[model samples]
Target: MREKAQESVKAVLPVMVIVLILSFLIAPLSPDIMVEFMTGAVLVIIGMAFFSLGAEVSMTPMGERVGGNLVKTKKLWFIIGTGFVLGMMITISEPDLQVLARQVPSVPNMVLILSVALGVGLFLAIALIRILVGFALAPLLILFYLLIFLLAMLAPADFLAVAFDSGGVTTGPMTVPFIMALGVGISAIRNDRHAEDDSFGLVALCSIGPILAVLILSLVYQTEGSFSPEIGRNIATSVEVGQLFFEATPDYMKEIAVSLLPITVFFGLFQMFSLKLEKKTLSKILIGLVYTYIGLVLFLTGANVGFIPAGNALGTVLAALPYSWILIPLGMLIGYFIVKAEPAVYVLMKQVEELTDGAISGKAMQISLSIGVAVSVGLSMIRVLTGISVLWFLIPGYVIALGLTFLVPKIFTAIAFDSGGVASGPMTATFLLPLAQGACIAMGGDVVRDAFGVVAMVAMTPLITIQILGVLYVRRETQSADRSTGVEYQVDISELFAEYEDDEIIEF
Candidate 1:
């Protein structure tokens, strides 16, 4: 617990420092708002610590058990149906998707949610089949992404960013841990060279479902409403700051409860019917569920109530300046650090490291993700300023990302694709999205066309950067092996024996 807290602090503190610097020098926020922001930061840190620990103890185990048992049945239809049903249930409960659905005014909340959920369900079932049958992940990614881009051409122009953004947000904190663990559980049934590689790419494939689903839905529904940023309230006193978080706590408590309920219920049912584990293990999972609930409540409350307003305010202030172009560099800087603060990134990095047996270190993954997100944010800032179409960036970006799949190791490709989704969790939605929206508002740009794709941009760049890391790693390893192969092995035992006196040679 203590170690987790320290890790959480390290992850969050960098961004807090950046925000503080911005607040002091560039974007001067009111004292009251600053108080709110600081309070929220503390909550975020604490929440992340609990959440990380909780996921390890609870969500991961439950997912693994369920997945393993489901596959043990050896019934293809049963596995597919269970996978689809679980996918939809979990997607419907994901907080990030709900947040996104509210932001997207074109489609009704239920309609958008159901569409995204269905996409996830269908793709999840496909992912299960791929694992069981040992299909190559890259071909599926290439095919589906091609389909997505083709549909993008026919979908409404305004819906492009939102459609792509759906892919990122759907595989958020709530969804990543279980889905990743479930992959591991299912892949465990296979005893081939590709099992470990196959354990990944589930999140990657699941992410695509939302984009394709939303794009197809966009063809039917005309985008009607303009985008609106959630405005922050005026805070006058310290008491009000406390009051603000206190008030937001209940709503988040309710939201997190709703978010957690479906999975908990499913797990319970699975335990009774399939798992039937001993009480000791079940008790630990139940406790972990408690921690997950508490952590998510605090996390969402702090992010939505405190971080969103601060991000929006800072963005508005900076973009309103005469030299608003600085927003590009500033956005890049924030983007570099903000991704580290995402809860799911921690899970992904840890899982990748564990799965690879430290061949891919967490530090390396973090650096790659930071670089990816930094570039993505810089590109997004350009979009905000210029009102450019998202397709201009996405089409070429994905082409490069998909092309790299052929070059990098299969495991790296899977991790890279999964990292894309993991990178764009709640932090991106609450802070980065609001920041882009705020900047777009200041620049008189269309928020839907400009700001809505920040999450997608964040999601896309990691695919390239992580693969590049993989390329470098593989090159270094090959070079070392080549050098080792070139060297001749020789050892002289006579030199050591020469020093030994006859007095010590009593064995003769």
Candidate 2:
């Protein structure tokens, strides 16, 4: 547990150092805000460690067990029905979704939230069916994205970026652990060689559901409002920073309790009806749940109270500088490290390492993800500076990613798409989004049109970069096979066949 906590600190420390350096060199902040940011960073590091450990012990096991049990019954309707219910239940409670819903001005919070949840539920069912039936991921991706774009055409201009961003934010820290584990559990039942490949793409499919659903909803309900920038409150004294965290604690506790209830109840009922696990295992899960609850509360509180204001302030200050163009490279640099701080990235990377038996190391996955996110943040900064449409980048970016899908291994395609959502977890929503919004505001750009797609961009880039890694992996394997064949050719044919002389000998 202590080691996990240290790992979280290491992941987050680089970003913290970058922020401090910026504060000192260029984007100096108010003493109060700096104090708050420092305090929040501490809480986030601690919270992330606890959350990661809890997800390993509790969420992963529960999801896997439930998924495994559901498939054992072999009832198609039951599987789809359970998938839908579970998807909706888990999504409705997602902290990142809640944060996103609050920010979108056009749609009513409940309307958007329910729309996103329903989308996830439906797509999750589709993903389950695809796995069971052995459908190809590439074609389904092309088809659904085409549908999303068609709906995007009908959606209000103001809602277009928000619609796509919904997909990225919905599959956040809480959702990824459960959904990824569920895929593992379901695919475990399969005896096919592609079962490992099938364990991925569930998150990828679930991500698309919210985008399509929200875009359709946008067309049906056209409401016009603007995102109101959060006004910074005056802090008279440094002590007030501690007071701020204290006051925010109960609110997050209540929110997390509400968010966790449906999933908890659902899991309990499932266990009673089907799981029937041993007492010791159940006790461990319960304890882990406690850890998850506490960790999430602290994590969200730090992010919302500490990071958001600091990010906004920093962006505003930097963009107002004489050499405002620095924002682009600065954004890219921040992007490289910010993804490391995301809790879900750790989960996905560890899962990939384990699934591939270390053939794909977690370190390699992190480097690929960081590069992808760096490009994304650079593009996002360009959007902020110039007020360009997100479509310009997204269209070609996804086109290239989908094209690579055919060229890479099936498992890489699945894992690449999954990494999109994992990369845009809570840290992106809480810190990067606000930074973009702040810069957009400074540049007099439309916050919705310009700043909102940062999450979507963050989500899109990994699809291409990871698949690039896939292309290299395939080449390496081919070369290894060739070298083995060459070594075989060097052996004496007479000697090779000598051992089999007593039996029926075969010649090439």
Candidate 3:
């Protein structure tokens, strides 16, 4: 518990420091807002710690068991149906997606939420099918993405960014651990060469479903509505600050409970019918569930109430300056550190290290994600300032990302795509999205078109950067093998990569 708390502090502290520096020196926030931000930061740290421990203890094991048991049945229809049901339940519980649904005024909250949930459910079924059949991930990704773009061409301009943002937000802290573990659990049953590679890409594919669903919905239900920004309230007293959080606490507690209920219920059912695990293990998971509930409540309250308002105020203040171009670099600086703050990132990094036997270091993945997010935020700020269409960047960005899948190790492609979604977790939704929205408002730009896709950009860049890391990893390994063997190696690139993959997995 103490170690988890320490890890949470490290993950969250950098963003706090950056915000403080900006608040104090660059764009001063009101005293009450500062107190709120500080108080929220404390809750965020504590919440993340508890959430991390709980996810590891509860969600990961539950998902793996369910996935493993489902595969053992060897019934394709059963797997598909269960996968879809589980996907919808988990996605509907995702707090970040809920936040987004509230902000998009044109669509009814239930309609949008259900649509995104359905998208996730369907793709999750497809992901499981791919793993079961050992189908390649890249071609499927290309085909779906092409379809997404075709739909995008018909999607209303106002809906374009929100549609893409849907993809990123759906794979938040609540969803990533379970979905990734499901992939691991399913792939564990496979003794094939590509099982590890296939263990990823579930999150990647699940991320896409939300985008396509939202885009298609936009086409069918086009309506005129402006982006709704969170209104920052004025608080003069310390008592009000306390009252502010006190008032918000129950709402989040309820939200988190509702968010966690489906997964908890499903796990309970699985335990009854399938797992039949020993009492001690069940007790541990039950306790973990309690911790997860507490952590998420605190985390959501702190982020939505404390961090978001501050982010908006800062973005508005900074962008209104004479030389607002500073926002590009400033946003980049913040983005670099902010990705570290995402709760799901730790889970992804830890799993990657464990699965790869440290061949791809967590530190390397962290650095690559930071760089990718930094670049993405910079581009997003430029869009906020200049009002460039999101498609101009997204189309080319994905093309590059998808194109690299053929060049790099298959595992890297999977991990990279997963990183895209994981990288754009709660912090991006609550802080960065508000920041972009605030900036867009101040710049007299269309908030939906200009500010909304910050999450998408954050989600896109890691696909390329991490794969570039994979390419470099491949080149270095090739050189090392040549040096060790004292002979130049000439062979098909895929063949060489396969040799490395087998050797790396064996070294574990």
Candidate 4:
């Protein structure tokens, strides 16, 4: 746990330093706001550490146990039903989703929230069934994205960005650990060689569900109110900064409680009926849940109260500069570091490392994700300045990403897509999105069209960059094989599939 906290601090510190430097040099902030930002940074680091540890100890295990048990039942309907319910329950409780719902204009919070929840639930079931039946992930990905775009054409123009952003935000800190583990759990039941590869695309598919759901909902229920970005409250005194956080703390505590309740109740029922976990394990999970709750409260409070205001202020300042094009490079730099700070990215990297038996290193995954997010943020800033339709980016980005699916190892495709969702975690929602919103407002651009797609952009780039890494990975393996003197060894694309083909089935 101490080590994990240290890791979280290391991950977050670079971004904090970068922001401080920016504030000092380019965007001078008020002292009170600066202090609040610094305090929030501290809280975020600590909260992330605790949350990461807690998720590992509790959420991951619980999800895996439930998923594995359901698969073991050998009743298809029961497995699908459980998966759908679990996905909905966990998604509804995602704090990030709630944050997003609040920001979107004219849509009732519950209406948008439930639509996204249902999307996740339905796709999660499909993901489970896909793993069970050994369905090809790439084909389904292509098909669904086509469906998403078709729905987008029919939906309101302003809602396009929000629909795609919904997809990214739905798979956040709370949702990632459990949903990813559920894939692992369900895949554990299969004795087939491709089970490992199948464990990956659950997140990828679940993400798609929300985009499609929200786009369809947009067509049916048009938003009438125009988006109006909230202005951050000014802190009149230095002491007010502390008071600001202190007062907001209770509100977040309540929010976190509400967010965590559904999952806890569902887990409790699962424990009572299906898992019947040993007392020691249950005790550890309980403690971990407490840690998770506290960590989330602090994290959300810090991000929403501190980071959002600072980000908005920074964006406004930067956009007001004579040379505003610098926002692109600056946004890129922040994007690179910010993704490293995402708590869920750590979870995804760790899981990938374990699943692949060190074939794909966590460090490599981190670098790929950083590069991807960096490009995304840069493009997003361009969009904010120009007010271009998101379709301009989405169309080509998905094409390149999907094209690479055939060229790279199958696992890379899955990991790449999964990384898309993970990269756009809480930090992007709380900080980067606000930054874009501020910039959009300053530049006199449409907030809904220009600012709303930051999350989508963040989500899209990983699909391409990770697969590019996959190409290099294949190259390295091929060269290594060719260098052997005694025997002529050939590297086949099928060899990449060999890792998952091992018949060793994991047992709960």
Global lDDT of each candidate:
0.90, 0.88, 0.90, 0.87
Candidate 1: residue pairs that collide: none
lDDT tens digits by residue: candidate 2, 97-140: 77677666666889888888999999999999988888889899
- TM-scores, all candidates, are 0.95, 0.95, 0.94, 0.93
Q: Which residue window of length 10 is worst by lDDT in model 4?
A: 499-508
- By how many angstroms RMSD does model 1 differ from the true structure? 4.2
Stretches of candidate 2 exceeding 4 Å from the true structure: 493-508
Worst 10 residues of 3 by lDDT: 486-495
Model 4 clashes, total count: 1
Write model 3 residue lDDT over 36-122, tens digit each, in one string: 888999999999999999998988888889889999998999999999999999898887777778767778999999999999999
RMSD of each: 4.2, 3.9, 7.1, 8.2
What RMSD does model 3 have? 7.1
* Alpha-carbon deviation at 368 in model 4, angstroms: 0.4
291-388, model 1: which lDDT tens digit per residue? Answer: 98898888888888889988888889899998999999999999999998899888888888998899999999999999999999999999999988
lDDT of 4 by residue, 1-508 (tens): 7997898788888888988998889888777668878899999988998898899998899878888988888999998898898889878877777766865667788988898899999999999999999998999999998888888778887788988998898897877888898889889888888899989988899999889878877877767436655455677887888888999999889877887788788889889988999999999999999988888888888888889888888888899899999999999999998998888898899999999999999999899999999999999999998888999999899999999999998899999999888888889988899899889889988888889899999999999999999999999999877686324334564465566634532221
